[model samples]
Target: MPLRNPCALLPRRLQVVASLTLAVLLFILLLGSHPTSTSSTDYIHRVPYGPAIQSSAHQLVENLPQIPHDLPHVNTPAWLNPFRGPAHTPPPEQANSSSGEARWYTDFKWRNPFSSDTTLDEERAVLPPLAERARVYTYFESTSKDDKTKKIELELLQVWRRAWWAQGFKPIVLGKPEAMNNPLYRAVQGLELEDAMEKEMMRWLAWGNMGTGILSNWLAVPMAAKDDTLLEFLRRGEFPSLTWYKGLESGMFVGSRGEIEKAVKEAIAFPAINTTKSMFEAVGKETFAVEADHGAIAFYSSATITAKYPLLATKLSSPSTAVQGLALLPQLINSHLHTTWQNTFSSGIAVLKPLPAHTTTLIQPALDIARNLSQCPSTPIPASCPPNKPRCKPCVSNNMLISVPPVLRNTSSLFTIATVPHPYTLTSLLHSRLDLGVKFVRRETDRDSWTVAATKELLGTGLSSFSRLPALKDFVAGSYGEARTLWLVAEEPVRGDSELDLDALDWHFGFQLPRSPVSDGKSVTPVPGPERRPPPPKEEFGEGPPLSEQELMTERSMFMQAQMILRDSATGSAKGKTRGGSKSFAQTREVVEAWNLADTEVWRFVRAWDARRQLERRGWEEEEEGFLGKGTFGRWIDKIT
Candidate 1:
C-alpha cells in the first residue's frame, strides 16, 4: 500500500507511459536467454490459447470454445490411415505375425485334404501282399449230417475256384468242418454275412489292383444252370444268365489297381465320395472316379471291363446282353451283305429290330428250347425225364397250348400246388434264351393296368431297403439263448444249406483291395541277373512309317470280321433243327472272343444303370408314400421362414 502512493502522485498521462515502459522491460527480461524470432507473434495469433489470453479477463470465458469428447466419424480403410503414414510405420518384424496377408494366404505344400501320412500308412497296412491280392471270401454253416449237403459244398467250391481262375485271380476259401464251434471264426463269418456288401465292395475298388473279389455264401455257386457247375459252364465258354437277385448276386466287386488306389486316396481326402446313398447319385455328382455297386451280375461283370479299359466307358449305350439280343438278326444280315456285295454294303447296312415290348414275345425263343428238351422222343422213359426228377412230367408247352395266349400267369394258374412240378425253375431257362432280359414279377398290386417293365419296376420299389442292407439288426437283437446256440455250433459243420435253410445259420463275406498288380516291384517273369534288352531305334518324325495297300486292306478286313464275331457271340443261338429253338448257330468261339473284347464296357454300363434304376425306384416309392412333401423338414422350414 505504501509503494502505490508514489505512482498515484504522478500525472495520469505520465503514469500510462511509465506502465508501458515497465511491461516492455518485463517481456525483455523473460526473453533475454532465448533466441529472438519474428514468427513468435504469428504463432501466438494462430493458437487458441493466445487469443483467449489477449481478451479482457471477464470476456476470456466467452472467447474459448469447449473441447469435444466424442470420437470423429471415419470410413477409410486401415491401410489408408493418415496419422500412421510412412513416417509412423513399424518394422515388419515388430508387427503382428498372425495377422494381415501372412495369415490369409494359403501355403501350397499343405493343399491336399487327404494328405494325412498316418492315415495313409494305416490304410495301406490293411492290404495283403501282391501274391495274395485278389481274395474271394465266402462262408457256409450247415447243421446236419447228410451226404447231399457234403456233395453240394464240394461242388460249390469247385465252381468258385473255376470262376476265380477265369477272372485271373486266386481263390481262398474261408470255411472248415469245425468252423461252427469257434467263436472267433463265427464272428469273422458273421461280419462277412451281416455287413452291407457295399462297404467291402468300395474297399476292394479302392485297394484292388485289377483284382476282382466276390463275398458270397456257399449257396452262391457260379453255374449257368442249377445243375451246371461253374467249371462246366466255363469249359463250354458260357456264363450263367440266371443269377440270384438277377444282375446282382452276392457281394461282388471288380476294378483296376490304379483306379482303386486313386479312388481310395480321393475318398480319404473327400469323404463324400463313399458316403452317397446310391452309385448313380455318386456318378451324377462325379464324387468318385470309379463305378458304383449296382447289385446286379450283368452290371458288375460289365463294369469291370470299363474300369480296366477307359476307352470303352463312353463308346456304347445300354451295354447289356438284353440289347445285344435284338441286334442278332440285323448283325447276321449285315454279315451276309458284307460277304455278298463287299463295297456296296458300306453305304447301306440293315437297321436292328426293335425289342418286343411283350414279355411273351421276348420269351418265345427260350420257351422253344424248353419244349425241345422236354420232348426227347428217342430216349427211354426214365432217361427222357428232366435230370434230378423222380418221374416224367407233362411238357410245359403242351399244357400252355390249351390257353389262347399261352402266357405264364394264364397257363400255370390251372395247376394245383402239389402238381406244379416247380414251374418257377423254368423261368431261368427262359431268361437264358432271351439273353438274360426276363424280369420276374410278383403277385399282389393295387393298380390294374401297367406295362410288363413298368409293373416289374413298380414291384421293385422299397426292395433295396429290405435286400441291400446287411442283416446286422437281426443278429444284434437276437436273445442270449440263440447267441449261445450259435457259439456252441460255431465250429460244427451241420449239414444245413444257407441258401434254403437259414433258421440256425448266418454268414458274411469281406475283401481287401491290393496296391499293385505285380508284387514287391518284381516282374511276372524274373530276369536272369538283371540282363537288359537294348532300346529300339527311334523313327523320323514325319508321318511315322509307310504301309502297303495290301496290309491296310488286310487290317480293315480283320476289323470288320471281329465286329461281326462280337455281335454273333454276344447272344447265343439255340442251334436246334426246325424253328423250335432260336434259328441262330451257337458259336462258342465268337462268344468267348466277344466277351474278351466287350466284357468291361458291358459290366460298367449295367452297374451304373443298376444304381440309376435303384435310385429311381426309391424316388418313385417315396412319391407314392407322400414322403416327398411331408418328410423333409428342411423344406417346411424354408416355406415357413
Candidate 2:
C-alpha cells in the first residue's frame, strides 16, 4: 500500500506533513546507524588529549616492561616515572622488614648521609629523663623604668614561675643585670642597631645562649607544656629548630643547644637594619601559635612581625591557633582573681552588710533594748514566801534575750542569742547569730525580704515612674550606712490565734501589693487569676518576629547579672559564718576588701564579654550579604533563632 503512493489519498497539507515526517525518520535512522565517529570525536574533545596521542601513549606503555604485582604503587605521575626501575632490594639484615620500614630507613639514610653512627644512635634512642631537659627560660624587662613597673614585672615573674613549675619545668626569669652578665648578650650589645627598639629586642637572643631547652617570652603561658610526645621530641639531641606562630620566632621555641646558639649568633652577625627581623628570620620552622589572646600577647606580636616581614613566611605545620581565644581570656583572669581572693578572704568569720533596703533606723534601738534586757538582774523568789503567792518569770530568762521586728511580730516570733566563753568572742558570735537569722528569714519567707520585695515593687512601677516613689529616691540618695541597716530577727513558731500580717509587712518593706481583699470596706476586690486563652491557630507558613535590639539587650543584661551574682555567691559571702568564729576585725575588713576586689574583676569580665559580643555582631554585619541574604534582619533572625 505504501508503494501505491499513500500520499495520494491525503490533502495537500497532510501530504506535506507526511513527507516531512518521513524525512525526519530517515535522518534519525542514518544518525543511529553511524554514531561511532561522532561519539568518538565528542569523547576525544572531553578527554585530555586527542585519539592519536592517546593511542600512541597506550602503545608505548604496553611495550614497556610490566610492573610486578607484588610491587607497591606510588602516587607519582606516569610521565615523571617514564623509566620505571626495579623495586629496591634491601640488605639481607633488613630483608625480613616490611616495605614501608625499608623505605623509611632508605629515606632517613639518604637525608642524613653525613650523620655519624653515634649521632644516629642518639637520634634513634628514646627520650632522655625530663629532669635533664625540662628547663624553660624567659627574659623579663620592665617596659617602663619606674618602681611600679618593676613591681609589676616581679609579680609577672612570680606568676610565670608558678605556672611553669606546675608543668614540671624549671622556669628561670632573667633580668637586665643577668642579661648584661651573659656572654651572648655582651656579644650582641656592641652591634649597631637602627633604633632603641632593636637594641631592646636583642635581649631575646641571650635566651638562646642560656639553654638547650625551650625559650619563651614572659607573656607566653604554656598550654601543652606537659605533652608527652612534644616533650620527647624536644629532648632529642638532633631535634629541629621549632618556632611558634608564623615562624617569626619571637614567642616561644625549643631546639638543641647548638642549633639555637647557631641561629642566634647568625642573627647577631648579620648586619641587618632591623635586628629583630634578622633574629626572627634566622630561627626555625613555624609550628602552631596559641589561638587565645589572654596571656598570648607574644604570639600576637610574632604574627604582627611576620606580617611586616613577609619574606619569613613558611608552611605552618598546623593552621589552627591552639587555644580558644574567646573563652580563655576570662578564664585566666578569673583564675588569677580567685587565687588572690582566697588568700585574702580565707578567714573563718566575716561581717557582711545588708543591701540598701534591708537597713533600717530601727536596728540601733533594737540593739539597745537587747543589751539592756540581757544585763537585767534576775528576780529571786524568797524561801519563806507562801505557796499561794503568784510565781513570776525572771527579767532575764535562761540568760538569753529576744527581739522581734514589728512587721513580723503578729505573724512570727523572732529572737537572736549569741553564747561565747569570753567577752572578746562576743562580736564574732553576734555577727554569726545575725547572719544566721537573716538567712533563715530570707529562706522561710516568700519575697518578704526588704531588698527583694522592695526592688520588685519599684521595678513593677516602670522605669519612667521611678521618680514618683519618694522612698526609693531617698534609698538611692542615702549614705551607705543609712541605706544598709541590719534587722536582727529569727523565725519562731507563731503562738495563739495570730495570722500572717501580709499587708502590714508589705507596707513596712515598701512593697506595693497587686491586689487588696477589700476595696474601701464596701465591696471585695476580686483577685486576678491566671487568664485562659484559646490555643493559637496552626501556622501553615511564615516566620515569627525577629529578635529586636531591645530584647537582645535585655537578655544580655540578665545573663551578665546572673553571672555576677553567681560569682559573688561562690566567694562564700553568702555562706553565713564559719563554725570556728575566730576572725578578728582586721580579718573581717580583709574579707570585705577581697569581695570588693573580686566584684571589680567580675564587672571587668562582664564588660569584656559585652565587648566580645559587639565585635562578633560587627563581624556578622560585615558578612551579612554572603552569610545572611537579608542583611541585618536576616543575621538577627539567624543568631536568635
lDDT of 2: 0.35
CA lDDT scores, all candidates in order: 0.28, 0.35
Candidate 1, which segments miss by more than 4 Å at Cα?
1-170, 173-198, 201-252, 273-641
What local lDDT does model 1 show for residue 190?
Answer: 28
Q: Across residues 1-641, which tens digit of lDDT does each residue of candidate 2 receive?
A: 33778788999999999999999999999886855557667766776657878998999999999665347866675567769874433332222112211111112232221212213321121111113326677765545444443444454444454455433355565545445555687666676665554544445555655656677776554432133344344434244544443332456666666666666566666555354443555433332232222221223243542353222222221234212221222223223322221222222111111221212221322333233222222111211111111132222221232332222111112222111011111111222222222233234322212222233433443432222233332232122211122222211111111223322221112221223222223212112221211111121121345336565455444434333333344353433244445323333333332323322222222222223223333343364324332532211112211
- Which segments of candidate 2 are over 4 A away from where they belong? 1-133, 182-187, 195-201, 224-249, 274-278, 281-641
Please give the lDDT score for candidate 1: 0.28
C-alpha root-mean-square deviation, each candidate: 34.8, 35.6
